[model samples]
Target: MSNLIPDPISNVFKSLAIAVSLLVSLVAAPPAQALEPIPVPIDIEALDITSSIDLHREAGNRLQVSTAPGADGIVRRIEVPSRDGTNTNWAVFSLANTSDEQIDRLIVAPNYKLVGSALFWPDLGSSRIAAITPSQGIAPERQKSLEADVFLVTLDPGSIVTFVAELTTPNLPEIRIWEPDVYEETINAYTLYRGIILGISGLLALFLTILFVVKGTVMFPATAALAWSVLAYLCIDFGFWGMVFKLEGGGSQLARACAEVMLAASLIIFLYAYLNLNRWNIHYSHLALTTLILILGLLGVAVWDPSIAAGIARLALAVIGILGFVTIAVLAFQHYDRAILLIPTWCLLIAWLIGAGMTVTGYIANDIVQPALGGGLVLIVLLIGFTVMQHAFAGGAIAQGLISDIERKALALTGAGDIIWDWDIDRDRIYTGNEVEDLLNLKRGSLEGPARDWLDVLHPQDRDRFRATLDAVIDQRRGKVMQTFRLRSEDGHFRWFRLRARPIIGSDGEVIRCVGTLLDVTEERTAEERLLHDAVHDNLTGLPNRELFVDRLRTSVVRSKAEETAKPTILVLNLDRFKQVNDSIGLSAGDSILLTVARRLGRLIGQQDTLGRLSGDQYGLVLLSEQEPDRIVALADSLRKAVRAPITFGDREIFLTCSVGIAFF
Candidate 1:
């Protein structure tokens, strides 16, 4: 029955069995926890002490101490040897107030500081405790002080006593005998040093803020953030805020945390903004925000539990700092063309980080973080100044390029005989970059008014059509259009122009403006007219040829047929022996004789008559008159006598004669 159960029941049974097995294993296991003290102490012997006060070398120098904590969990209570030669000894020293002034304080301190270490003296009162090695990191002012990393004891005049300290390390540190004048000088120097750093960084931040506001550029904002971060760092590191603002306890720690977070976040922002990472790698931007959040979280932990958070913060900062440097370096390398100016900045930042790493790992005893950070910050300010100069140069170059392009286009337009014009439909105005007097033979500003002003200049035959075409363009009924028409100028002469216009559409798909160009086609129109004239008229004598003469004769015949009192007459005249004149002289002489005969006949003919060149030397004349043969005979005689007149060719003279024939209808 069990084997025949469904698969679901068996699967549930197997899962439950596995869960039971895991629970059994966990219950059987021992709880894992730390067995050592909160801060594990290192024991030191007095025989290892290398240096001490001259008077106490024999008695107090042979002391042994343990860095482990006392009953209160604070590092104090130095234990002395019970027997004559036991495991440990204590350092006993005496001080005599020889001067008239009373000695108020004494400082017992190490010559150098170590991380995760502190020194305590119960004999000096509770508030007089000092860190031998500051776990919270050294401030810029404290790092430079001669007596800051020491324990202080208060005493009256002429008081002699012995002091004991838990040796935090095997190394013996110096004991500072504090004097009124020396302590005053040390405090003053520390303050002055810190004030200079703060002032310089503050000014730089202000300068960068001004630049950001003026330039309205992303680079300036990012760089300004960097400068402000430096100011924050100097404030936190030098304890200047503690003096001025009195931010104590959690407030000071929190302020320091915020400053550190700003420092890291600013570096990330500066790198991405300098490179314009939104155009390149958006993922890096997201990563930068994530890392910043992580840094903030770690800092929050420091406010609650500093011991655990300090280790984590250091490790996290080291990793993040290295990663940030590498990421920016890689991006800079990839975008070296645009990031060339940032090379000095990133290089100095990496070097500063290396110095900080050295300080963290105990290789460097002195503080390098201050100088490294200060130098890097100054470099960033200089880079911003240079970037501004480069931007101005680039702007100038772009403007010059635009000017050259306009000049080049202007030359091309002049060569193409195109004059540009702009029309503002909303204003009902037309503007043209052309000489009104040269193009339209008008006064200089005649066409500078409204659209109606230009329309008024159009020839009467084209004025209505021009208005219609222009309306079509403004209405966007046509994408672009070209039309040729005659325009009457100021001198009453008409000139042909081809106007081409295109409508410019707004975002709403309505035409807001029209840009047009005009081409003067007067010479072109004249050539076309001459071509039409040559096809129908004789080229040499400038008289209507056979085609035109026949058309006129046909019209006359039609008219005469319709009218009862009117008749049509035609006359043909041929120059007799005209070939002899050309053969004797030249074709030029023959042309001159023909011209003379045509001119004479032109004078004799009435305004209603038509005269044309029929052939090489023959001419024809038609008239609308009575169909009387005597009238035709008289007109033919007149034409014959007209052709027999004398003609002159240059200096040569010749007489021309013609045979005439007449017909009546």
Candidate 2:
């Protein structure tokens, strides 16, 4: 029983050991041969011939077919492992033409910037080969087609041939098999599409550049830079640069890298300026500046070392992506109109960048990303253009409003005697209507020069004041000016002119021009002065009224107190029998007698003293000089005598006696 149990246990251990050994052998074995035979479709015009293909990455350009490895379950578009530019990618696939006739096809690698490619046909036999090199150009065996690199392949009926494509490019390539006519048609459509995109982008760039020159706004130049950078990148991507410059493979790659770096840097710059982060938030602005500096530094590094430029550009895109989203959020929070407008476009751009980066890094295939990139770019451009146009339209509306205002003012100032003038501050030139010279009574073209010439025609007292008002308008960059000054006419008389000016500010907030009307106010000033004089004087007697006398007395008292001088003396005098004289004579005779008394008193008082008609038959006098008590009494007696001696009203000799009262402060 013990022997039988041991035998069964030994058999079980042997079975387990054999199973472990088989599993180890299978795990340690090399990958299966990838050269699977793929049947060519006899019915289809074009075929996505990459499903059975195998991709293997090998270091260095000198790859041997014997050492090529295999991969399985590949799709129409496959992402091969990427390495430095020195590495070679091999795609192995076998094609069997099952038809009775021979099939001619084109093997296409749809990348414009492909560095170099080679094809080994007839079951990977190097004897039959087609190759293309960057320096020597295309070989006879390879076809020169549109933007994509092309290779010729022929399949015989009932024959199976494995093909190996050796690709040496920075990124992995997407391979396709196509008929000649279909490829030509596809290329034609692609060219047209790319042409439209490039044309629109170019026009947008030019428009923004013109705006920058015309308006001098920060956002214009920034957007222009971004537009130009995008255009350059598209040029490189679409193979236009290659056709124009005919650069070598390395040089072309370097140019592409530089273009990409510039694109990212320009995007960062545009966002910083477009969002107005510098003015809105201090900390974010600093962060943006720092990021910009880093990007510029990367650009410098790319110039110095082109091999790592793509990596640098990717890094820049990533950095900007994070910072840009944060800034957009902040702007949206603040309810910035432009930032709100930019949201959808900015999101599309970020998505494209991410997808493109993934495609380049082999996280995704090129086929999916390429189409999205094209459509996204166009959409982003359209949306950004729309947003920028809002600013342009807003500026145009403001300018139009200013023009309407100027037109209205001009219409209002088109009166027969009004003189309209415009001062070009920068050129120091003054332009005026012909009426200015006629109004000033000067010769023709007398005031048709610089602003200083106009100033020379002004009265000496008004010249400095007018200049000061104009300077203030230009310096402060605010407010309109309404100054009333005197301008000297040719006849040596100064006429008062009222100047009403409104300054026109440029984009930089500087007063570029001043427009105004010069209206003659000489008659108005004369009327005003006459009215002022009549307000303080008695009409019948033509002497200072009681209000004027009181004002003068108050001023004299304050001056005496301030200067510690003698206080002014006041005397009130009344004519005796004045009411009896008015009652006997007519009212007209009474008025004439009062006028005669006022003239007599005016001749008695000095210019420094005040003489006034206080009321009917009453007079008041103020002496502003220091006088002894006897002198004061003598002055009061003189005033009384002057009023009492008035006579000869009409045909009668009116006589009067006066009583006087004196007061001292």
Candidate 3:
């Protein structure tokens, strides 16, 4: 038997198929006997209707309700005559005998403002006996159900009667009847499901709105706007707004319509930013303009005629939505970063649009359409929110990197003891880092001086020159400048500093700002000065050597000739016993004697005179003269006496003499 299993499996499948067919036949078979209908209670006292002896009559078949005098959209009463030959306002329910028993407590529901009502009768001639009206007041959640607002009536197994309803204001003249338990169950179940959907959508909207607030992303706000419009539309259509807020009339419609316009505007804005629409080859400007115009038109309609505005807004948004879907599809194919996110979002939007359009156009019921719309809108809102946050994080990451780089550069500058500065040429403002005070050796707040006063802290002699240098960089078309100058610090001591700057040029080739570094060069300048002095001054006697002496003489001679003054005089003095003294003692002793003689001779000169060592054991002097040979003789005699008086060297008393020869030009 096991070896024949393959053939057995085929036989078993045939048997299972026959069993399934039998089950289907049994499930689909007609009932053998009719069941009795359950009789439910219809509480007549709940109707709360007061009847009149004669019904109020209006001339026309259709009634038009308007606001009363001195009231803002408030109408007290309305009388609607029957459209047919019947001379009464009647609500008729046609029932069939599906079961064997009567339907006792069948509820009839209508849409109306239920505050003040006239009466409900079984028939025109019958006395008002028993009717069922809403037990609860303004139930928004319940309004989402098929059995939200209703009146209960008793009917036979098979009967058709025209029920008369006298009213203050007439609503759309259509009604539905259902069994009490079925009505309650359906209402409760539908309310629960619809409430959940609405809640999810509302929460999604709130989440997206928060994202928009946090990230300032257009997508979040746009998605939220669309969600709000859909939510409001559902609320208005299902009478949820009236139930929740106890508000009625055109005001609710206006709010819903306004939400629609906002939805359109928000979508346009989001698409523009997300898709970079302006940069696209095809101009979206006209589309944007058209959207704006439509939104404006919707707004005008909402204010002037709110009843029709909601429909117009829905139609406009649907058209815009289709266009947006196409645009987003194109963008996605082009591989835009956010377009991938929008593709799924647009698909959900399509579902929402189809569901909403079907409901609005009366193709489907509110229960089916609302859940579909709510779910689709929730997904759309969440997708947009996620994309927005993703972009925000990416942008934040790049910004953080740039900020970190800037911070590192600043730290490096601080560590290197460099002062970074910026000078706004047009504004005449100077900005500097904290390192400025440290580099400039300035007191804590001294750096806050005005731009013009920046040069005030410079050394008085260098101030004009520094200003000239800086101006050359700014006004003289110099692009980059590097110069050294002395700046006076807070302690009143001048320190050398080097300023290096590069101009920030504007588009018109004008310097807009100058960014630079200021470095303390006091140590460098001091070292340079020492090296320069060592190069031109005598090392042993600390007197100007031949190089410096000749330079001064040349300068003086040129100046004297230019001024027509007296010619300068140059005198060379040779130490007579300098070599004999060196041979007698030592080189050290000889050097000491030469130093002593140089000092004695240096005191004979005036401020306008020059004294220098021309060479080993040879000295020179320069003086200004008015061509008095006698004056020259007297000066020469003074030098000879001074040099001849020099004596001591260590423990020895040495006498030194020099031969002086004077020359004049």
Candidate 4:
């Protein structure tokens, strides 16, 4: 039975081995097969009707009615229809020319033309017929006229030829009409428009800048209108809307020449307008006028003597244009901020870049293109003019408003505040208004000239900090500086003032002056000082109380630990039966004793030392001296002995022996 059954472990091992072998084979093997190449689908259906026909039409059928295709095969059959003859038709196209003289005498004409569309035939494709709108038949011819090719065949008088009019079939692909000669006659038209715009914009910008400098009456509205017009024209040109559609007489060259002449003239005029050359120099104005006249003369020459104008003259003129604009840009960049003048000039300068870009990537030109590419700067001048006008009108208003705002704020600040002061750092003057006297009770006329005028007036404790703040405010050029300081009064008292100010902006956006307000906060400050005093000092004696003493003790302990050479000591003492004596005499007598004790301690303590009334009949002293502990103990003993002197308060001999605590560092 066991032999018949399969070994489970061996079977499992065999399966595992097979899987491992398969994985190993996969790891060691090359890829199963090379990837198949994907084929790009060529959609010949998208080619233009003309290209398709040119590609697909029969080689023999490449002939059109136009003479451009030299003499070819015979037009086999001719036919036309008459409106009355056929069911409501016009003329018949199917007929034989019974009387056929030479084509010089035989003529056929169309009564009307369809205004809806344009038609073109292409001969290039497998089925080279590009059918646009299915089969659109033509109106029937009124009569028969046959013209035979002289080389192919000659028709004698009265000789017959059958002619058929068939517009029933179409064969070709679709066409994208956007792509044409990218830059052509339209460039001239657009250039002319742009030149006009540029000239106007430049003139306006110049005029406005002059007005801003001279602070004069200027024409801004006209400039703005010109700018808008230029922009509109540029948009129209760039959008390619019907730019070359006006080429009727003489062809595209005439239209282009017209546009170029207009735009170029606009540029010259704009330059004059912006610079106000008329006012600046009479000779320059006349010269500018002559240059313009010469440009006009050049246009006339182009129209009349194309041979001369098309020769080396154009190259010479282009060089002049480049040099003149470069010179103007260099000057404008240094002296004036005229984007119109700069941008238009730079546009002409980078023609090479634009040309290269357009060549590498073919672009479709539109109707708007004529006004843009056509050497017309009329639109550009107009645009600059309008911008200059806008800046003149609105910028003046803004600057004036800002100045008024600053003045109003300054006046308001002085009037509303209890103190007004000026820090003329350069002039070394600290001028305070009459209100400062009211706020600080300081000598009014004294602070007008020098820093030392008020230097001696400050509380000895606050003098350094007050001087530091003043110096910092000016040196760092802080904006809207805020300072809260105590100023010494004529009465030998200190008063608090909160000074705040904003810096004035100059035409160059720099701070030219500081306008500030000083509010008298002495009363509020006094209240705050009193609150702090109550929190840390005895209300009656004005000495540091128990809380302040403990805080000082902790600070001394931290300092003593840091210094090993000199350690801090705290002397704790209790009165020698002073409580019993106070009860025997009275609480008032004990109070008198305590007051005397507080006064003595405060006097004996140095500037850095502190003295405080810890509690009734208890006092503390802090001594910051290099003296030994015995000397400190002696000082404490002296303080205790000083308090023991009998107090003569309202003719009463109040004697009290007290213990004193001294902390030494």
Candidate 5:
């Protein structure tokens, strides 16, 4: 180290060091200090009043409104109607606006029923009018403007009144209100969008239906068709789109009614096509027929001159919609395929159903009955479209690829399939995909338990073997094995499966995990058994024929010779008059005699002895040393006598006999 500099240089250097240290401290301390009072912008969403009120129109009077200036000489236009025919006379308009810095108290409105009450506060909702319905009170020093609907009598025979309210913001924040017209326009836009969507989805559904019918797409088309029908039903609001436009009057209401009828008809058609409700689905067809009948009745009522028909139709449509909803739910639950839809599906269903109900109720209550499921429909269609796209491109989309794999696996094992699972003895948990539940008909809620407990599902005969095999696999530590065994399906049906698994080893060459897949082998096993039967047995008679008989004879002889060094008695047999039986009674009768003779021979043989068909009507038996050939001959004679007795096939009797041949080794 060098010596310190003189006073001026040392002082300057010390100051610089202190300055650097202070700067560094300032920089380092800021982030922590600043984090102390973190600013969090909480998004706020508030709900307020929205009700449809009829504004009655007066003819030859243009509806008008005016407001007197305040004490501060501030006079703004209070809302008034542009003179259209309606029952709504006036309405009080209010909005809320506040800065984070200050608490703003809003003094607003006598929200009471008044004749000629209509206000124009389209600005109120646009400003996100956070309205607090304050009681009649004195105005505060810093008061906000309170707008109300007013009517100025004017020159028209049939003029409708609309109230306009405005909150003129003077350098203050603004919030919006849910304006009726704006909402209407928005809903109309959404409905239009829904129309376009319906067009595309309808075409898509039609295409799929045709393709699936031609291609025999099995289950996928049905699921896809149902999904499409749901989309259309939701967009159509079960036909409530008709009522909203009908509010404009003239042919509009009729158009709305016709639209409803068409939608209902279309809905029935969709159900018919989608569910194939015509032929085998008798119950669904009946239900659908009833729904169509109701639709016809509703249509008749709606067209029964003037408004009463419409009212009745509206009510009927609501009822029909509810019924259809129940039907759809039952079908979906039964199918449970793509059946288990997420929230959007429920939202769409409820929106249309609710809209239908509201249209009916609103009509009876004499309120402005615009009961279209507009926004909700928009939300559903967009979501459903997105969902469809996501599903269609599932394999390509990274986020959805994994999900689709799981879904497909679950779907594949949905019915009439077996799921065989294996667990590593070392690993505490079992590994199987979602397919396990579908295969086993298990609720996701019911799948957890000890691994060995699953042994209960195995057939009693196979359980011991299964357990032994598992133990062996575990003991061996790193072997791959494929095993066939019997297990119980969810429906209590027994099924065979072939399961295979292997252990994944760690870097230390120790088995860390095990993985496996299961395949249902019941059909294959049955086919294999059939092949074995075909190969070994005579087709006409149910007996162990030559190949198997000879094999059994050789096995018994070898076993007998090696074990006790005893001579095994062998009795060879032939039907004594089989040729005569065949010539007299025909081959079918001869077959019956052979069957009867085989049964007799089986009864005559002891439990330990073996018997088999040697060839044609010839047979053989192997007995232990204790059994004699003479007794076997007697047994063969008894079989011949039994065959000589009356044999029945259809309505005929026949007689037959077999020649006995004896041998000893």
Candidate 6:
């Protein structure tokens, strides 16, 4: 009992000795090896400090400094897991400087497009946080001029400092530690590559705009809009917009979201027109239009909340991809050649979208994602540009060939003494070949004026008719036109012309011009008149034949009955012994004697009377006079006396007698 109850001073001394031993043991242990000091100018990837780093997830967006070390959450691998938007990710790491000189380094979060804000805190310095964002104002501690979240870290020689990084981002953060030279080199390379892409995109947009102006096609403008939208997105993503416009807080993010939404909307519009959906499938076209409207509606949401709008934009992009694929498939099934050509391009675009989406959603690392996306964008542009140009210019090529062919044909026609004329209805101008002046026997350049000048050259009798025919052709949109009119030559002679024209219809299905050939038909008209005259007259004798005589008698009879005017009489005279004369003498001599008898009979009738040759030896007369019975007998006797006169035919005397029969109407 006396041993158990020890003395108070000895017990106190023993406890002190034990505490001193424990303290001495702790002091002698060499600080647990001080976590291998990181050398200066180190490669973050080679060092692979992620395994030794610690991560702490906070529940809210607010920044909170924790005095406790992040021992509970240590990252065991190089890959950093993604976090949701509701939480903040804090990465804790030790940056120990084992070098002889003080070293300054940059800790960069390269995925600036995804990161909202990044805060850096070093335990060695005054308890202060250096925060950086894409839209932050410039400061010495943060590299705001760059498009990345960059912070400067300085470490003294033989110093080990623990750092905490507060990252507010949905995607997995990529942190890189680099010396100034290496970072500058990397940034320069990135800038060069991005600049090339943006330049190409801008040029493409301008080209598409020019195409729209020239072609006046909906697809061209839609493609131009899409290209411009893509350019805007690239500008925003590459930090060019930030330099130009100081968009703070959510402004930059909202603009990016709106650009994405516009891009999707423009893409839909372009696809609609490019695929000719309205002409092919009306219902599908309506659906695409509705989808476009919805995509545009996302802008409103983007104005209110960019993150939500960005998510919707991604969804819209996915929907558009599906819709485009289905549309192309449907068109391909219908044997649309353009849709078939777009299949591989669309597939490539879909693959690129999937890869980009994965990168954005943190499923994939961002190390190669940005460059790949940029390269993929350029490739898609080239592929689509090639495809569109192949089809768009194909029709133009065909039309150019056709125009050349037409020009060749027109030249041949002009060489053949025909005039090729183009009537511009819109301007009311007439363009004729140079040969027109020579053909019309007019001064040079006489017909190079307005359409009225062309009309002035036409005969008065034909001008109105020609105008009417042209107007009808234009109004009715007739494919072919044929008209015969007379044009006045410089000699004041009217010459007939035959116009053969074809209407040149525009894309709007209106007749814009009439292209035709003018062929002079004056000789043809003269020959036709001669042939008509020959049909009515006798060949040997310059007198009307029996058919003409009958036609005149019918007309006279109808006039006499209708008007109760002077009556008409018809006299048929037959030459006696004509066949005997033809047998005695030759046929030529008989013909000569008949001509002499016809001349004698022509002197006996009045000017109003018509004398016609009835047969080889017979003659008929239609007298439009009031004749009584005795007058008729007298006329018949006079005709007989005229025929009874003897005539000399080729040194032979020929005598012929005529028997006359008269009829009255």
Backbone clash count for every predicted candidate, in the order shown: 4, 0, 1, 97, 57, 0
Residue-wise lDDT of candidate 2 within 161-266, one digit each (tens)? 6555555543334567787788788778778877887888888889878867766667778888988888887887777787788754556667767786788888
TM-score of each: 0.40, 0.49, 0.41, 0.32, 0.41, 0.50
The positional error of residue 489 in candidate 2, measured at the CA in angstroms, is 38
Best by TM-score: 6
lDDT at 388 for candidate 6?
A: 67
> In lDDT terms, how accurate is model 5?
0.50
Sliding window of 10 residues with minimal summed lDDT for model 1? 119-128
- Displacement of residue 64 (Cα, Å) in model 5 is 22
The candidate, 1 or 6, that scores higher on lDDT is: 6
Evaluate model 4: give its TM-score. 0.32
Query: What TM-score number comes out for model 6?
Result: 0.50
Question: How much does each candidate deviate from the true structure in C-alpha RMSD?
Answer: 22.4, 17.6, 21.8, 30.8, 27.4, 15.4
Top candidate (lDDT): 6
Candidate 1 per-residue lDDT, tens place, 550-588, comes to: 998998888777875456688889888988999988887
Ranking by lDDT: 6, 2, 3, 1, 5, 4
Better model by lDDT: candidate 2 vs candidate 4 = 2
Model 4, 389-493: lDDT tens per residue? 555566643343234566677656656754566666556666776777765565567667766666666667766776776666555655466778777776667
Candidate 6 residues lying further than 4 Å off, grouped into runs, are 1-52, 59-90, 98-102, 111-140, 166-172, 361-366, 390-392, 396-665
Worst 10 residues of 3 by lDDT: 117-126
TM-score, candidate number 1: 0.40
Q: For candidate 2, report its TM-score.
A: 0.49
- Greater lDDT among 2 and 5 belongs to 2
Error of 5 at 233 (Å): 25
For model 6, residues 393-488, the per-residue Cα lDDT tens digits are: 887422332245666776578568777778888897887767667877888788876767767888888888888888898889975779898878
